[model samples]
Target: MRRSAVLGGRYVLRSLIGQGGTAEVYCACDRVLEREVAVKLLRQASVEERDRARFADEARLLGRLSHPGLVTVLDAATSDEEPYLVMELVHGPSLADCCRGVALATTRVAAIGAQLAEALRYAHDNGIVHRDVKPANVLLAEDDRALLTDFGIARLLSASTGHTATGTAVGTAAYIAPEQVRGEPVSPATDVYSLGLVLLEALTGERAYDGSPAEAALARLTTPPPMPSTLPAGWRDLLLAMTALDPADRPTTVEAVDSLRRLAAETEPAKPGFTGRTDVGESPATRSTAGSLPGSAVVTAAAGQLRTTGLGAVSRPAGLARRAGLAWRWATAAVLALVLVLGVTLWSNTLSGRPPQRDTPAGVPDRVQKPLQDLHDAVEGDR
Candidate 1:
């Protein structure tokens, strides 16, 4: 459709934003409301009963749901056998796009998971289940906030839209739960499992499951999802429980959010106002008191030992050069004493500024005495 076309008598289609299997979302101007909106239109061939119903189901479900972390659906209608939905136009790319080729910090991943969990908890409380919670389904704003979107595969608990199923698979393969893969009935745990995979990928550069759809789906059934060995202990524990094989063993949305919050708190950058800690590159000797140290103290401690930078008395680092400097000073004194003795004994007969004496040390060559004389002169001159 051209930009001149208008849908439902009020929305003017301007440009295409995204394309999916069942719908095309366009950036549109709301004629009646005088604002920008995202219009998701069903394809002409997809105007069949099943497709329209699914589109309508998403519209109705999202129209009633509201949260800071969820995209808002504004309106829904059918015009001449063509159905479309008007939604809030999110201004950023999906989490999948932002996460591509990057390894996110654990605290950041936890913050994103916390918001998504809160949104899911609200949906669950209202008798709705977001069956798909992959990275592509989340929109991230420029300010680092995440908003969960795409309710195309959501199941309404009230059975009004007829989405309930057993032994039916309906989610992305890489992040789908084991039960979903096995075509079993799904609950909130299913979404939790999917989010767990997303978090795993976010924390680590690699995904837990990789391969074609068939291979990825079948592998999780027999083999456990990969648990990252390098993550912090709290992160590992939470992810393990979230991706448990059994739905009952998995953490609830509330519990998962709590765990994420705790993980974030533990990994959060140390702040003077908050009672939290950051474990990045800290040693065991300083880990306990790292958060309590001042900024200058941190820099000083990292640069050297717990020594004073002239602010007070300090302990010197046990360096080989400093120890050698003390040893060299003592050795220089002994060498000076020996050189003085040799100089007086060897040059007694040719003494300057003194009475001549007929005495010279036996078996001492002039070659050796000359070097000692130069050394004694240099040492005395230096003093």
Candidate 2:
């Protein structure tokens, strides 16, 4: 698509932001709304009837669903020669980019997992199964909020679109669940399995199943995903259960959400000064700086920034730091006051012509007594 091409008579395409297997996403300006939005157009090469139906299905599914963790579909036109979808423009990188080759903090992983699980639960509750739940489909917003996007392969539980037939597996190879590979039916558990893989990758900084699509799919059927010994017991157990071979054994999205939230909370005490926000920016160069400072320092610095920006709550650590600083000042003042009082008392005795009291034994050896008395006299004279 050329720059400046108007779509649906209102969206002015500016530049290409992303290109997937079947669509090309562009940064566009909505002339009617006067705001920037992302426009996803079906690639010319993938303008077949099946692909068109899938694109229309995604638009309808997103329009019906509403959640903070799911990308919102603003508008769509699938019948025109240049079919396109308008969506909220997320200003950050994908989860795959954020955790490319390095494991994120445990707390950060759990928090992000919880957010995705909640989104999945919402979709499941509405009878939709997001067949594609890989890291690439998950976008991290500027504020570190994880939003699930790209429902082009999502299946409606109550109805069949006829595009995806039985025995035809349709998802990314690395993140597909075992059952999905068998060409069997899918449910919420399928999404949970994919999410488990995503979380495992985030924690280990490597794909659980690697190789070509055929090799990865076959490997999952025979070998279990390897879990690292360094992971916390809760994380290990949760991941193990979520990726169970039997879908029946896996926890529901609701259960997964609760477990993940608990896991996230468990890491909070260790981060006493953190505001629980992981600022994984749009690029690797702008990754979170929270790891560079102590937990308390991170809290203090974030609090200051929040105060200056007039955004978000600046309590807790900030308040604690202020109170501690005030107490330190008060303690120092009290010590100084006590020293001043003692000095004043000594000076007053000297000014009033009253000799300062001295502790001297009634009988002392002359040798020791002489030196002691001489030192005392010297001190008094100097005063």
Candidate 3:
């Protein structure tokens, strides 16, 4: 656990990051690649043939999965009777760290949920199941993207590790799926259910199912998750679908991911639209070509608003269509302004108090009178 141990003849251990029931994760230096890496070593006391195979299986599965949202496995081997996995060292706080007491921002929670769902989908597509999905398994980097980690309990669909029995529970109590608790076979749906509970905890900053481990695991057999009020639109429904008792009632991990991504977009902060507003540190060319997406769903709304001066509230994307849209708004403004000015002039002329000038009557030119009638009709039509 100290900072000087080396592993696999290359990774020099720096410090212990954290530990789980099966493994201890350490921050290490990959002297071969000159980069910092994470090393997961099975605790000496828990080391066994079955445990070692499961640990190695996780590394092999992760080695096959290449995703930006997933923590990359660099190597796995038995070093001095202890099996270890070298992985990409992520520098960030875990989701659990962020959700210490108060609920995180809905946008952040939704975004994390979306990404972890994506990672799960990737694993599922490759015949692996992350049996555990909770706040502790998700890391939040400075980039704000969620990184999924710790597949220590993942089961490969095709290979029989023979570690878990058919009827034995295998996940954390608070976030365990009902089927998992009953010792039923697991699928992607199991991860979905667990992720739903994790999302609920993230949103509420409290475990929806709380009690002793036994009580929590057994409660889901009959008690449904209590529906909450005042959530973002469609969020409650999504969670309900995810945590449904029957696998058929739950959304697939892919579907859950899509819903979560949409929810994230909906709850994101209001981003400035592509009008022409200058952003700090953004070059004019950059602003025109690459409109800043504040990662929100409000771009279209912001784009729809053009000020009276024909300038947009934010720099718009560079394209003929954007120019055309702006041009259309200007044209509309010009037409409205002309109509307004003409109407005001006509109204003032009609007022008897200002009737010093000769009124256009019987002797007036046909052009003037015709235009007047046309304008009056146009104004009336508008009303």
Candidate 4:
């Protein structure tokens, strides 16, 4: 559609914002509402009966859904020569663009994943399964809120939408679940698996499966998605569970939302100038004390001890480091105390006019025999 072209006599098409294999999305203006909206129109050349039906299905599905994390459908016309859908305009970039080959912070991934999972939960609750839940279909609003869009291949669990027959794969291969590759039936778990891949990609700055579409799709059948050990334990566990080969083993959308929200809350960044302890295992009193200490003091003490003692290179937890430092101090104190006691005894013998022993052990060097004999005599006298 040309720019300035009017659709449904109310929406005026602007410039093209996004293009997919089946449709082109344009930034359009709703003349009646006097607001900007997104217009997704099926490509004229590819508008067949199947594509038309799928477009209609998406409109109907989105029309019934109301969620902050989901793009709201404002208007749709499927009977026209070119079918189009008008939706609420999202102001920011797509999730794919936001994290394109760039790893996002763990907290950011958690926040986005939580929002997407919640949106998926709502859709699944309403009998909708978004078959294509890749990053491109997820929009990031100005506030960084994730809005799931483009339910073009979504299936209604209550009824069969003839566009996607049983045993037909219908999503992007890189983000699709194992079941999708095998052409098995799709469910909410299928969406969970895809979301897992999306989050993994966001965290790792790379696709879990990369190759030709056929190769990517087939790889999931035999190998599990990679969960790097560098990822937080919570993230690693959740991603592994979400991408489990068996759908039955994957968490529900509700569970995924809970886990993601928890992780997001837990991994939230510290406020500026915040001196509070980040370790959750610390007691309230311990945290309060640690927080009360000057930041420089804590850093200096830990770093100085670690550096001087050659323990800085050891990768140990804070608790272990503290224990090791304490042990080192104790051992040093014991050695110093023993040396002090021996020195005091030798000084007392010398002051008391007691002659130091002349005989030295056979192994003792002649140059140091006087001092060695004095030390040995002091120890024997003490015993």
Q: Highest TM-score: give the candidate number.
A: 2
Query: Of the pair 1 and 2, which is ahead by TM-score?
Result: 2
Candidate 4 segments exceeding 4 Å error: 1-4, 268-383
Residue 102 lDDT in candidate 1: 54
Candidate 2 lDDT over residue span 1-383, tens digit each? 43339988899998777776567788899999899998888778547777788889989999999999998889999898888889999889888777765677788899999999999999999999998787778888988899999888889898855576565455655677867755579999999999998897787666665433334544454334655556676776788778766687788998999999999888632222212123321122111100010000111121112221111132222211222122232333333333223332333354346776565455554444543444344334323
Worst ten-residue run, lDDT, model 1?
A: 287-296
Q: What is the lDDT of residue 268 in candidate 1?
A: 43
Model 2 global lDDT (CA atoms, 0 to 1): 0.67
TM-score of each: 0.67, 0.69, 0.67, 0.68
> What's the count of clashing pairs in each model shown?
1, 0, 3, 0
Better of 2 and 3 by TM-score: 2
Better of 3 and 4 by TM-score: 4
**Local distance difference test, per candidate?**
0.61, 0.67, 0.61, 0.64
Per-residue lDDT tens digits of candidate 4, residues 198-299? 897777656665433334443455344644546666776787678766688788988898999898888544222211122211111100000000000111
Candidate 3 lDDT over 1-383, as tens digits, reads 33337776898887777776456787889888899888888777657776777777777778899998898888888645657888877778777666644466677778889889998898899998888777777787778878887776788777654566554556654577767655568889999988897787677555555433334433454344543454543766787678776666678888888888888877443222212111211111100011111000111222233222111122222221121222343433333334333443443333323432233345544545544455444222211
Model 1: what TM-score?
A: 0.67
Candidate 1 residue pairs in backbone clash: 167-183
Higher-lDDT candidate among 3 and 4? 4
